[model samples]
Target: MPHPILTDLETIASSTAAENGFDLCGVKVFTHLKPMTMQVQIRHIGGGDVSLEECASFSAPMGEAIETSQLLNEAYVLEISSPGIDDQLVNDRDFQTFRGFPIEVAYRNDQGSELRQAGLLHKRSTDHVHLNIKGKINRILRKDVIAVHLTRLKG
Candidate 1:
């Protein structure tokens, strides 16, 4: 289990991100760094790429909140950014929001080699996803998809 402090930090970060017109994607603490660092990833609530200016704006208040709450005993580096176009489709909200978009799912083949399946995400359910690939509807379990990423189209 993650430390309670981490969860508290995530809450504060989430509130700050929401105020900044973003959804809190995730919060991570990297203890391997020299002074330790906290990374807070955010995504635009309405859907779009988050710019560096937005990250800066979001970081300032989040840092202040962490400092005010004394969430960390010592100074910790804080980083903020969008989850990026290729971030994994982990949660149901992600699957719903990205429906109808082209995505690439990496799965293990019979030989255990990594195989990729490209398709348009038609829909999703609690346990599986419906994909339109090669003019056929392929129903795949969420677990079968090792990684699901948005496929950036050339045109």
Candidate 2:
């Protein structure tokens, strides 16, 4: 379960992110640190890439909103960032969003040997992941998959 404060902060962050043309993807509040810490992850609307300048541009308004809310009693650190280009595909949304994009799948074969395959993401079923390599479709069992990651190809 998340702390109540985190929930409230997420609401505020989400609102702020929307005002700045971003979608709030994640939020974390750490109270264990000396002065506390808040980390926010955001992505541009319409699945566009997020730039560092955009993150910096958003920080000011977001910080102002947090300050105006008076949600924190003490000093805290606020870090804003994007989900990143090379982030692993971890959920159904990720699979859907990156459909038809290049990806690398790492999995274990029947002999327990680790293998890797790269291709255009086709789709993910309940029990398998399908990839289009060249003109052929390859399907790997979900249970045997280790990780699926977005890959970049040099032009």
Candidate 3:
């Protein structure tokens, strides 16, 4: 279970992202560091890539919201960024946005053996991920998936 403070921070960050026409992709808090660190990832809500300028544009409002909420009593570094192109696909929005794009899925089979497969993303369902490999659609159980990532294949 995540800490309540982390959840509250996520709520504030998410709301700030939405207000700025972006979607909150992820939030991570690192308490072990000297001053602590909070990293927030955001992406364009319209499915476009997030640019450096956009990250800068979001930083002000995000920082203001966090400071206004008074959720963190201690000093912490707030890092705002975009999930890079090669980052793993971990959310439904990513699956939808990258539909038909080339991807690689790393998973474990029923025998508990690790395996990797590359294909075009077909769709992701509640229980499985559908991939189009060489004109055939293959379904991989969600439980077995270790990671799914966008990939670029050299021609």
Candidate 4:
């Protein structure tokens, strides 16, 4: 979990992002590093990808919002970026948006080894997700999904 201040910052940033046609994908505050950094990941509202110019355009207001909020105690690097093609499936919207696309899901076994599956997203329900792995259909409960990301973007 992030600090309460960071959560507040995310809420503020989300509003700013929405007004400028952007989706605030994620926010992180790295306090361990020498100079703490606040990384903000965003995507274009229309979808596909986010461009460098779009990130630049959103930076000013985002920075101003952070400053005005008085959330940070010292200087920090505000990184604005696209969530990218490999963004983790964090919510229902993500599962629905990438439906029918290729996703690689992975989980850990009892021995701590990682197992992965790659296939088309066949279905998503209230409790489980179906993936067409090879020619067979595999159903995995939502709680068991350790990691899910689009593999088609990997090249």
Clash pairs for candidate 3: none
Worst 10 residues of 1 by lDDT: 107-116
Query: Candidate 1, residues 1-155: lDDT per residue as tens digits?
Result: 66558889889998988887898988989877878899999989886778999898888888888888887997689999887677778777788888888888887765678878788888777777788886798877766668888887646
Taken over the whole model, the C-alpha lDDT of each candidate is 0.83, 0.90, 0.91, 0.82
10-120 per-residue lDDT for model 4 (tens digits): 898899999888888898888887688888988877766888998988899999988888888797888898876677877677888888888988866566677888888
Using TM-score as the yardstick, the better of models 1 and 4 is 4
Better of 3 and 4 by TM-score: 4
Best by TM-score: 4
Model 2 weakest 10-residue run by lDDT? 84-93
- Tens digits of per-residue lDDT for model 3 on 1-155? 66569889999999999999999988999888869899999988887888989898889999999999998889999888988767789988889988998999999998999999999999999999999999999999999999999998647
What clash count does candidate 4 reach?
0
lDDT per residue as tens, model 2, 72-139 = 88999989998866778887878999999899999999999999999999999999999999879999
Estimate the TM-score of every prediction.
0.73, 0.64, 0.76, 0.80
Candidate 2 vs 4: which has more lDDT? 2
RMSD of each: 3.8, 4.9, 3.0, 3.1
Sort the candidates on TM-score, descending order. Answer: 4, 3, 1, 2
Worst 10 residues of 3 by lDDT: 1-10
